[model samples]
Target: MSFSRIKRACAVALFCLTLSATQINAQQKRTKGCLTECQPRIGIVSAFGGEAEVLLAETINKQEYVINGNLYTTGILRGNHVVIVLTGISIENATMVTQLTIDHFNIHHLLLSGIAGGVNPDYKVGDVLIPRRWAQPLEVYWSANSNVPAPCGTPRDLSCLGLKLSRFTSQPNSDYQIPTPNGPVGTGLFMRDTFVRNNSNFPNGEFKFDYAADPEMYAVAQTIAPKLDRCGPKNPSLCVAVQPRIRRGGRGISGPAFLANPDYRRYVFKTIRAVSVDMETTAFAHVAYANEIPFIAFRSLSDLAGGDDFTDVSALFASGLAESNSSRVTLGFLEAWSQKYPE
Candidate 1:
């Protein structure tokens, strides 16, 4: 019942298919911007507003991009194409923003600049430290022990007793043995998640305990370190009795705790040999390592982490000075790096 009807039906079907394809293409374009080669850019990340503001001030031709409630600024800093963002103040926030930055931008390198508590007595207020490696000291497993005193000759130390720990059940089981006067005893164990990322540069099947900063960047930072100012108008009284100098190539640790206990500070210094401690760098470092991005961190000490007093000095006056010193060195690094690797 008719050639024209059949021809019209075929034409209608063809038109619908074409329209569907067009809509699909449009949706894809909307969801993900046009795929193209991304310009090489460096990422400058800071933990909080104070840390970020210093870097922001150095940016020229700056433009802001708000994605998923995080602010990213793209601009030219010290003659390099760079994007800067703030990763709030904790591990969770730091991790989230780091991955987001890597996913959404063409970041070739990452630099985390911020303030930290001085762990190494050699480092004092307003001293900037560029640690070669970063780790989370708080990532551990705890063993439970009863208050009951150990039998004589059984050893009074809880760690010297063999105890089956309960935490980290999902991780591979291992016993931590601590030696005492009695003998090596099995305490609780700690094992980093080995399956986090599979990278040939890292130990296979083992989550790396420490993430190293790019050595090339570290070298560059060292050259610029001397030019940074140790004292500033923000806090002249808090300046180190001795001239505050930049310290490079040391361990930096991060944790959730706002560390201010003298005993814990001593423990951290003895255990990790960390020169500086902060709350965000290690988390960001971990993410960067997983993504195989080159990273370096510049942390200025705002106060002695319980070496001087328990009161929080970061909020009092030293924060600005720390930020200034760190930013100064960061700018110097960028300028020197640009001279070496002109874009």
Candidate 2:
């Protein structure tokens, strides 16, 4: 071959190689962008390690990512794509991790599964309750005592006390007799609605107590009412008196405190009309609402909050059953969800 022809052929080959390299780089950038923007997996969050043990064990193709000291395991769970994570065990922890999960991953829906104290007497140990909505009832004002001329009744009337109910014209408690949202959960603690920002809908926000779960997701949960496992594998002898059932809808409340008092439980059941009470649901709900993502919580009743007239079973005794029950329902819900959102 001629020297000029050989040199020209080499230059042509180099041009083709550069063109291929440029195309590959462009494709890589596009792939990276899609991964960051188009996340369609369900986010399954638990409050503690034990609560998520069953789900974590069952997850297939698990790949873990630790961000800011929080562990997130991404995998396919029960035929649906999901990312499972433990958000610690408090309202603050829940809020922080939920937002973190939302921020870091492309989450289409957020589902929280864990054990909660059954506020309503109707629900017993091992029963699962998926609340229609969740709220933080601990947003209260610790008011100063208003000395109202000697005896202020045995319980000390909240009206007589100097506690103020924000955004409420009349209290929702027995003394007021007015149907309202805000009320005094305790003597000095006056409950009020939480004010949250509109993260996506910038410069606009609302003041409300109840943050509702996704209607479609809630409906799917309601469809599956299978009997839950009443006994744990570790202790076959220890079983709940009644076969566990799943209840959907009604109010669910969350707060910073772990409620174990009978009188307070009665007040929560009667005044708040909450079906379940936990430490993290409302925080997750709040973040889900702010970020405008579909959200739901599956809370298995570990024990009756306050243990009023019921079998005084500690949460410790029922924790295994409750966690199992919650995870079962979560799997059911995810299975149903796959039908609607198959990817």
Candidate 3:
């Protein structure tokens, strides 16, 4: 073969190999984003604009990405590489975005910050709560009024044929289920226990309705509890009516509905023994538990669930300090975590 012809053939072979390799690298980047090797971020999630605004403003080296229509921004906040996701305002949105962030980025930990209703009567608005565990009270089943004979042990003394019935659909799980507080019984409403298995081959997942925040991460929050800001968002001099404080390690619950019923609020506090209740924390906690990532949350009381006396629904929004308090506590947690964990 002539030297010129051989040289031309060699160049063509090299060009094709290089192009094929480039395509493979590009596809890999698109799919996993190099899971472990990619920039590791502490995932911080908020449920709405009011909750996310301050934290998003302070994030440096900001870069934005949209996944499955959810907006996520990656940047360094409080000296930690973090990805912030605005999860709209519901359980489904929170679940989808949290998992999406885990799938697309190297998320080492997950944190949820937002304003929530004070379920614990002792707590008032502007108090930041760090729940040690979370539950989903909204995962429920509405029972039908049963005219059927009350089960074997339901008591024949209480007017046998006319007695209201309360029984578990799933015996084992129901044993641990949160009972309807001060119930009208069969008029219907039951908190059904759900199951979960992070990464198991067990045929039946474990019956679980509560997920705990990572203790190690919770400690960071506890450390900074005393240092959190208690000032107003607009005017620092104008503080909350009750001095804002941070309380760590209690329970929190999430459901689709905004908790505004005083009776139910009392029930939640009594039954789940929750300090705060909102729409996103439990969803985020559940996802983190499944992913085996460290998770924690900061929720500030906006109002007294249904105890607030307001004339207009639209006018009854949380004071700016409520969200600011939450965001500030979250930032302090992240900064403390960055030091404790060191990437």
| Top-TM-score structure, candidate number | 2
For all candidates in order, the CA lDDT equals 0.72, 0.75, 0.72
What C-alpha lDDT does candidate 2 achieve relative to the native structure?
0.75
**lDDT tens readout by residue for model 2, 1-343:** 9999999999999999999999999886444312333455788999756768889898899988888998888888878878888998899999998888877777888999888888888888888888998977677654433222112453334334533344431343332122236833335445556767775656755567789999989888877756588786556666778888888889999999998876667666677688989999999999889878899998888777767444535333543666677778888888877876777
Worst 10 residues of 3 by lDDT: 156-165
* Model 3: residues with Cα > 4 Å off, grouped in runs: 1-37, 145-186, 201-203, 226-231, 235-239, 310-319
Please, what is the TM-score per model? 0.73, 0.77, 0.75
Candidate 3, residue 70: how far the Cα is off, in Å: 2.4
Q: Count the backbone clashes (under 3 Å) in each candidate.
A: 0, 0, 0
Least accurate 10 contiguous residues by lDDT in model 1: 164-173
How far off is residue 45 in model 1, in Å?
0.5
By how many angstroms RMSD does model 1 differ from the true structure? Answer: 9.1
Task: Name the lDDT value of residue 177 in candidate 2.
Answer: 28
- Candidate 1: regions farther than 4 A off: 1-37, 145-195, 199-205, 234-240, 310-319
- State the RMSD for candidate 2: 10.8
- Expressed as tens digits, the lDDT of each residue in 260-290 for candidate 1 is 8766676667656889888999999988878
